[model samples]
Target: MKIRRANKEDVTAIVEMLANDALGEQREDYKLPLPDSYYRAFHKIDSDPNQELMVAENKEGIVIGTLQLSLIPYLTYSGGLRAQIEAVRIHENYRGKGLGKKLFLWAIERAKEKNAHVVQLTTDKKRPKALRFYESLGFKGTHEGMKLHI
Candidate 1:
């Protein structure tokens, strides 16, 4: 498996992976409505300087997994940076093969390269397995992430 930066051409596979429940777990409130234009918008935003969107591809050039890393610069910590990991997904058939780990580690390295002070992510409470996985990767549940439906 090859991990690399995602390009606009990979949007279709990325959307499919994002829509899979096993990967994204997006609830009805946060569900991603798939449309051709959605991919275009995502590509545009992901290419901006503050964001890094990546994809994991197999030898066949199929995008099997993906994640996004966003860098938020801060003034409070003396110009420190925070890297937020989101939109992690792997194709159902490719799960349990350590692809997630590789992609996550790649994101961490990318964050370090950008001089980020911390890396953060959030997962639903129902996903105990995913929570454990994140723990094993040195991430801790530090706070409650509350959302309000608009």
Candidate 2:
């Protein structure tokens, strides 16, 4: 599979993978002619110099996975850059084929290219298997993550 920066045309496939799982089924609205919000969000992310929204395509050029990597400048880590990996999703039909690992390897390499001091991500507690998968990637549960909805 080839990994590259995502183009506008890849949004639908990205969202499809994003919505294929149980948690995604609750939070994502995936359909043909997706809501304009997805497009708007895509445009905003696309315009941001700090954000790299990526897509992975199979040999036939079908989008099979996606992730968002954001570079954040912060006072912590000695005023260094932090690469935040989020919204990682692999197409349902493509799971268990090592595409997720490939996607993550690409992201981590990109993070290193950007000179990020650290790479970080948050996963929902409901997904224990996902937690294990991330551990296998060499990520540690170093801190407690908290959030509040508006």
Candidate 3:
């Protein structure tokens, strides 16, 4: 498997992966005639210098995994820069094969290369397995996070 920056053509596959799970069924739109909002968001992310949308592909070049990394410059923590990992997903056929670990480690290493002071991500509390996987990767659930949908 090879990990690389995602191109516009990879959006459809990524969206399918995003909608492959239980939680994704409610939040993601991977149906026929997908919404324009998806492409709009992709364009914004793709054009942003501080954002990276990545994909993992197999020997046949099919996208089987995806994640987004956003580098944020903050005034806090001695003017530190942080890299946030979000929207991580692996194709159902590719799960439980240690590919997720490789994808995550690749993101972390990319963050380090960018001189980020920290790497952070948040998982829905509903996913116990994901929480365990993250903790095993050395992430600490030290802070409480709250969000209000617009």
Candidate 4:
């Protein structure tokens, strides 16, 4: 398996993966039900310098996992930056195989290379196992994450 930066060609696969995830099903957050043009626009924005979309591919080039990293520049930390991880998903069949850890570590390394002050992510409160997994990776629940849908 290889972890690489995503390109336009990987958008469809990534969207499918995201849509099939638990949070995706609950929130209907992905543009999967929309036209290809919508995904095109999303891909364009995600691939910009300020944001990053990465995928984990097998030897045959199938995208089995994906994660998005957004750079958040902050003033409180004296111009420090943070990498916010979002939309992390692994293929259904590929769960329980440590692929998620691999992908996450890769993202952390990338964040370090970018001199990020910290790496952060939010998982749904219902996902207990996911919370444990993140804790195992040395992530702490430092703040209460709340959202209000507009």
Candidate 5:
């Protein structure tokens, strides 16, 4: 397996994996000829120096996982940089293969390279299994995360 920055051609596979889960079925659109909005968002993220949209590929060059890491400079933590990881998804066939752990370890190291003070992520409350998976990776449930859908 190889981890690398994602390209425009990778969006479809990434979205397909993202939409494979139960919660994803409600929120992600994995249709062929995906809405151009996905590309537009990709371009915007690609242009940002602090953003790293990554994909993991198997030996056959099939995209199996993806995640987005973003760095935000904050006034707290003594003007520190915080790394936010989001949209982590592993293809159905790739789950339990340790691809997700490898991807996250890479992202954590990447954050350290960028001098980020901390790396954080939020998972849906609906995903208890994911919560345990995250805890296994040394993440703590230190704070409550809240959101309001508009």
Candidate 6:
């Protein structure tokens, strides 16, 4: 599989992978034909200098996985930058084949290229298996994550 920056044409496949899981099926609405909001968000991400929307494609050129990486420059941590990984999803058929780990390690390399002090991500607490997967990859639960929905 080849990992590369996602183009506009890959949005639908990326959305499909994002909606394939239980939590995603509840939160994503791809059934009624995708709305403009998705593309709009894509454009915003595409134009951002600090953000990257990436996709992993198989030999047939099908997008089988995707993730977004954002470089956050902050004053804390001695005014360092961090790479935040988000929206990581791999197609069901592609799971457990070491693709997820490859994707993460690739992101880490990209982070290093950007001179980030750290790489961070947040996973839903409901996914114990995912928690285990991340821990297996050497990520630690260093802090409690809280959210306030508007």
Model 5 TM: 0.97
Distance from true position, residue 91, model 3, in Å? 0.4
Model 3 deviation from the true structure expressed as Cα RMSD, one decimal place: 0.8
Per-residue C-alpha lDDT of model 4 across residues 1-150, encoded as one tens digit per residue: 799888877877887787896667665455645566747767676757868888999888899999988888989798999999998989998989999999999989999999998999999898899999999999999999999979
Please report, in order, the local distance difference test score of every candidate based on alpha carbons: 0.84, 0.94, 0.94, 0.86, 0.93, 0.93
Clashing pairs in 5: none
Task: Summarize candidate 2's per-residue lDDT along 1-150 as a digit string, tens digits.
Answer: 999999999999989888888899899999889999999999999999999999999899999889999999999868999999999998888899999999899989999999998999999999999899999999999999999979
For model 6, residues 1-150, the per-residue Cα lDDT tens digits are 899999989989888888998899998877546788899999999999999999999999989999999999999989999999999999999898999999999999999999998899999988999999989988999989899989
Please estimate how well model 1 matches the true structure, expressed as its whole-model Cα lDDT. Answer: 0.84
When summed lDDT is taken over every stretch of 10 residues in candidate 3, the lowest stretch is 29-38
Candidate 6: misplaced stretches above 4 Å? none
lDDT of 1 by residue, 37-134 (tens): 75766767676899878899899988999998999999968999999999889898999999999989999999999999999998878789989999
Model 6, C-alpha of 82: deviation from truth (Å):
1.0
Global fold similarity of model 3 (TM-score): 0.97
Candidate 2 clashes between residue pairs 3 or more apart in a chain or in different chains: none
Model 4 residue 24 lDDT score: 76
Candidate 6 lDDT at 31 equals 56
TM-score of each: 0.87, 0.97, 0.97, 0.90, 0.97, 0.97
lDDT of 3 by residue, 1-150 (tens): 899999888888999999988899999978767788888999999999999999999999999999999999999999999999999999999899999999999999999999999999999989999999999999999889898999
- RMSD value for candidate 2: 0.8
